[model samples]
Target: MEQIALKAEKRDISKKGTINELRRKGKLPGVLYGKNIESSPVAVDAKELLKVLKTHGESALINLELEGEKHPVLMKEIQRDTLKDAIVHVDFYRVSMTDRIEFNLPLVLKGDAEGVRMGGILQHQKRELSVKALPADMPEHLEVDISGLKIGDTLTVGDLKMDEKITVLDDPEEVVISILAPKLAEDTEVPTGEQAAEPEVVAKGKEKQEEE
Candidate 1:
C-alpha cells in the first residue's frame, strides 16, 4: 500500500456547465468526502490522474492535496462516457489509515492451468474479492496460482492465502475459478438415401389405398 500524491483544487458546484468546461480544459471533475468531512467539489489534472491510475491501478491509495491540506483517499467510483470511452466524473472517498475499511480487491490468476493445457476449459468466476482491512495493510491485488488445477477442480475464496490482518468479507464457499471438462462436439447423423425416400413411398401407398 504505497500512497501516491495528487494535487486538487476546489471547484464551483453551482453550475453544471462549469464542470463540463473543466473537462474541456483537461481537468477531471471529482468530489472528496469522508465519514467526518463534508462533500467538497474538486478538480485535478486529467493527465496526471490517468498517469497515476495507469501506474498504480484503481486500488492505489492516494494522498490528495487540496488547499494545502492532505486527504488520504481511495477512488470509490469512476463515471465514464460509454460512447467515447472517456472518464467523465470520479468520486474519491477519504479514509483513515488506522480505521478498518472495506473495498473490493482485484484477483489475478497466474500460470496456465494443467487442465486447460489438457483441453479443459478454465472458467474464472470471481474477479474481485471483498475485504476489510486497515488501509496500511491493504494489498494491491490477490494472485492465485492455477498451474496445479486439473479438470473438475475448483478454487474457492476459502482457499485463498492472505495476510492475517485482512479479513475476507465474501462468502468462503464462493468459487473463484474452476477447470471444466472440455465440451464435446455433438455428432450429427445424416439420413441415408433410402431413409429420406421412405416418406415419399409411404405417401404413394396411402394414395393407392384411398383410390381402391
Candidate 2:
C-alpha cells in the first residue's frame, strides 16, 4: 500500500463545543492509538485530510507526523456529518510494517461474465474480503476475474488467488459471485368469453346432479 504524509498537532481541548470551534478554523478532531503506544488526542488540517481521503481511500497507510515524530498509521473509522456528508471526526490506528494487520479489501470484477452476455443475471455476493497480511504486503483491492463464469456457475472464496504473504480470513465456501440462468416468464391463462360466463345459481340445499 502507498503511504501519504499527514501532519497533526496535539489537541488540548476535549470539550465538544471547543471541537466545533476548531472545525470552524479548518481543523478536524482525531485520536491515534496503537499497541504499546499511548493514545493521544490530536487535530489535523481538514483540507489536507480530505485530499488524502480522495486520493488514497480508507485503507491507505498514513504517515502521521506529530510533534516531530512520524508514526505509520491506518484510518480505522471516520465519523461524518449525515446531512452535509462531511467528515466530523477520525480514528487512526498505529501500525508497524512487520506486523500482520486485518483489512477489508474491496473486490473488483475484472471482466464481463459469459453468462451475463448470454442473458443470465450476474449476482455479486461479496463486496469485500477480510484478509490478514503484513502492512507492506496489503493490497488496495482484490481483482476477481469473471470472464469464464457461465450460467449457474459460482465463484467462491477458495477460487481467489492471492499473494502467499496474505491470508484470507473468510470462509472458503463463501460465494463471491454467481451467474444465474435467466428466468422464463410464466404463461398466464386468460379466460375466454364462454369461460368467463357465470354459472347458473341454485337455492341453498338444492343442487343439480350429473346424470350417468
Candidate 3:
C-alpha cells in the first residue's frame, strides 16, 4: 500500500517511429488515463520502472510525477516482447485512494505440506484471486500456509483469512490448493507353479494324440 514515486514525462504520440526511438533511448512508452483525466501519452525510464516493480511489485500504488503534478495510479497492463521478454508498453490507471477497486491478487503458498512428505502430490489449483479493496488496504500478495495439510486435504477460497477492509470476489467454494494421494504402481502377478505346469500338460496331450 505504500506509494512509490516515479518520474514521467509527456510524450508525442504522432508516429510509431517515435515510440521505437523512445525504447531505443531506454525509455518506456506508456499511457495515463482515468475517469477524470484525458488519455495522455507518457514515458518513463525503463530501468527505473523495472526496479520499482521488482522491489514493490505491481500491486503497490505509484505516484507518477509528471511535470509539476503527481498522479496516483495503478499499473493496469504491461505488454512485453514475446521473443526478447522485454517490456514494450504499459498502461497506468489513475485512481482515488478512497474508492474501492477490483483487481486480481496473486496467491503465494508457504510451508511444505505434511502430505507431500508422506509421498502425496501437492496440487496448486488457483494462483490468484479476484479481490476488491481500497488502494490503501490492498496487499502485495496473499500467503496460504500448507504445513498442516494431510493427504486428500483441500483449501478453498472460503478458508482464506482476509482483512475486514478487503472483499474477495471469487466463489467461496473454489478450491485453491489440495494434497492428493500418490499414484501406486499396478501390481504384476507372478504365475503359480500349478498355473505354469498346466500349459506344458496341454502341449504334451496334443503330442500324444498325434502319436496315436
TM-score of each: 0.86, 0.84, 0.86
lDDT of 3 by residue, 1-212 (tens): 78899999999987769998998899999999997899999999999999988987877789999998999999999999999999999999999988999988889899999999999999999999999999888888989999999999999999998988999999999999999998765345667789879989999999999999
Model 2, TM vs. native: 0.84
Candidate 1: which stretches are off by over 4 Å? 185-212
lDDT order, best first, reads: 1, 3, 2
Which residue pairs collide in model 2, if any?
none
lDDT of 1 at 96: 94
**Ranking, TM-score, top scorer first:** 3, 1, 2
Pick by lDDT: 1 or 3, better one = 1
- Per-residue alpha-carbon lDDT of candidate 1 for residues 94-187, written as tens digits (9 for 90 to 100): 9998899999899999999999999999999999999999998888898899999999999999999999999999999999999999766544
Better of 1 and 2 by TM-score: 1
CA lDDT, every model vs. true structure? 0.93, 0.89, 0.92
Off by over 4 Å in 3: 187-212
- Per-residue error for 80 in candidate 1, Å, reads 1.6
